[model samples]
Target: MSQKKTVYIGPFIQCKTLTDLDICPNGMIGVDEGGRIAFVLRDERGRKIPEGDGWEDAKIVRIQDHGFFFPGFIDTHIHAPQYPNAGIFGKSTLLDWLNTYTFPLESSFADLATASRIYNRVVARTLSHGTTTACYYATVHVPATNLLADICQTRGQRAFVGRVCMHEMSPEYYRDESVETALRDSKACIEHVRKIDPEFDLVTPIITPRFALSCNTESLAALGKLHRELDLPAQTHISENPRECDLVRDLFPESKSYADVYESAGLLTPKMILAHAIHLTEEETALIRARDAKISHCPASNTALTSGRAKVRKMLNAGLNLGLGTDVSGGYTSSILAEAREAVFVSRHVAMDEGDEAKLSVEEALYLATRGGAKVVGLEDRIGGFEVGKMWDAQMIGLEAVGPETTELDQSAGPVEVFGKETWDDLVAKWVYTGDDRSTTAVWVGGRLVHAKEGFRL
Candidate 1:
């Protein structure tokens, strides 16, 4: 079946690098049948469309005055089953919150029906926020975990689904029964995802050992070995909370630090994505950088749980790949735009404690939400940004306008307002600070229209 070729003409904005954002007031992008971006014409400058190159018959989508095309967000780390528990944690920090809110809800996933309802909503909700790619942590139940992958595939979102491996320090009823069961069940989920998406073009299975405190040595080692054997990307938590760090120290006395636990278990590698590294030591940062491992900076979750601010500037200075995560339920929001705003605020907190050098600019934060996240999930070449040859994962962002003939109906264009005088940079800043999912008028993944608001036609 041949796919249709579409040409999108609009104002395009994207992070060109860590410090620069490329904004083309008049741009044209061509996406081929296979969902890959085939050509990008920046600032076409009144040139007519090239004819006899198969572009004459292509479908053209033109943007309105108030809207622009931006690359879709990438959520580097999120808990799929925790959607129901979002914003319910009351004064409970890491360990207690896990026992009270996280575990019980995740355990209910043994009932596949309940899992389906939650997984479906989370996938849809994240897609509405323009998250085209996500790295998801599913529960220990293999069926439910596989269902999560299936839901993402059906919803047309890119995802990495993992069956969490936690064989110790968790409630007996909810945890994996043994090391063998943990490995076996994890393998089953991985194979299920493989069978569903043979080439893993849209969905892949990740090795997830819940965290050092939840898993024993044997299970961690086995999961690491599986990570090596299958050459899969792995995700886990590290140094999220001070007490969690203390517990890791006590649990693995032989290891030098919390990061050492994974390093000693043979789990630290370039393919690993470690979440919430808020309180890592100098040596730990060096170790992670040396291993070429990536970090998912979950600022919203860290602040919500009263976890200390992560030194993102330090991590970036150390040459570590960093990305944003909703850490939903803990973070209390599904939108990566919210995460990007939170990232700015979190860096300010760091700057207050450790000078202005610790701060992060809006451009850097947006980069983390897109390009940096692509690196975290090991999809640097496939997703993120508006480059030719990358997948067409993007969103249409519309901002409101205040004019002389303004009426009540015109006020519904979301929180961002354009006075018709702001620069492109200022417009992006307004979107970052005030825009919500409402600003995401439409979303597309792999060049397919996946979500659109009312009045937004494909």
Candidate 2:
């Protein structure tokens, strides 16, 4: 349980809806010992709010000048073990990139030492980037995957850890030996997560079939069976590349389309999170929406690998719940803010081809980062925004203000520059377009201080 009863005071920002941001110029929020928000109040005069049942010793954390508290990012899909190979996929698409850079690096996770080194850095790195919650795909090794669960639990970041299952089409050295071994090892990893977080309060287990081509028909069916029996959340890759989609046709001829392969295996459900649906047909789209499965758009990874642009606006219009994912090494960067920027850029490109309706405004992209992400992870009521009962999973964003306090040598304040004339929306747009990790000064998960950069204080 969290021991901190913290009172945070300052400006706050959140998605009021799909097209607008809820910006409170002066606000205060009280977090109780259990990490749930005890209350949220606002006043023009910045007056103090009433203290709750707890007698008056709550610690106070205030946002700095020109800063605001925004909901922490949720990365709905990422490969934890592939973090080492980030930005190394040079001139290769998904298939060849997997063969050359991804598999070889992921295979090294068989050594617990490598898993420890990389997992530690990846967790810290993502936390620094203001990712308070992540859905991670660890390597096939049970011990290594379990270590990842332990790291997230100990670090206080909300996570869903999955053991990657690729029974065939993968290299011999890294692939699961058989369908039985795949199920067994995946179960072992799930049990490990249970042991670490009994109620899955901070970390849970997800059944991850690497992709359709990597797993045979029997393995996918068996894994789906296990999913139903355990009632667990599932994740997998979908139609990411044109050639990969065509290959799925030849491999699973009986299935109607790429989405049908998982449907036939009973893996398409509300609890499933399918990443990179850049090439889904209308039938496949309707099927996924009917099933209520979520989508994690990875624009950076899609563009980095020269994958086709994902029609995010089209998906939203279909009434599908959508979220953003860094996709880590596959997409290159681990920062979700950068991924949000990529989403806007990719949407503009789509608008160029289609029409202006395809362009996603800054508000829409940020909504996908926070609120839409919460819906995708099935935690809409818990962590998406500031409310009377939501958990305090948030980040403090600071932009340098130009004034008498500014000096020529103060370059450490980060990439965003603000004059006295910009509105709140303009400031947010600047951060979305140009800001990086340096602007994410502090991060919190469930009222606990998970990450705080240098010079940040409570």
* Model 2 per-residue lDDT tens digits across residues 361-439: 9999999999999999888999889988999999999988888676685756788988889999999999999999999
How well does candidate 2 score on lDDT at residue 308? 90
Q: State, as a TM-score between 0 and 1, how close model 1 is to the true structure.
A: 0.98
lDDT, each prediction: 0.92, 0.92
Clashes per candidate (backbone, < 3 Å): 1, 1
Q: Candidate 2: deviation at residue 385, Å?
A: 0.9
Q: Candidate 1 residues 1-458, lDDT tens each?
A: 14688899989999999999999999999998888899899877796666766878888888865879999999998999999988888999988898999999999999999999999999999999999999999999999999999999998999999999997878988988889988889889989998999999989999999999889788888988999999999999999999889888898999999999999888999999999999999999999999999999999999999988999999999999999999998999999999999999999988998999999999999999999999999998988788889999999998888896765565556888888899999999999999999988889899888898889875
Q: How displaced is residue 56 in candidate 1, in Å?
A: 1.0
Candidate 2, pairs of clashing residues: 301-331
The alpha-carbon RMSD values of the candidates against the true structure, listed in the order shown, are 1.1, 1.1
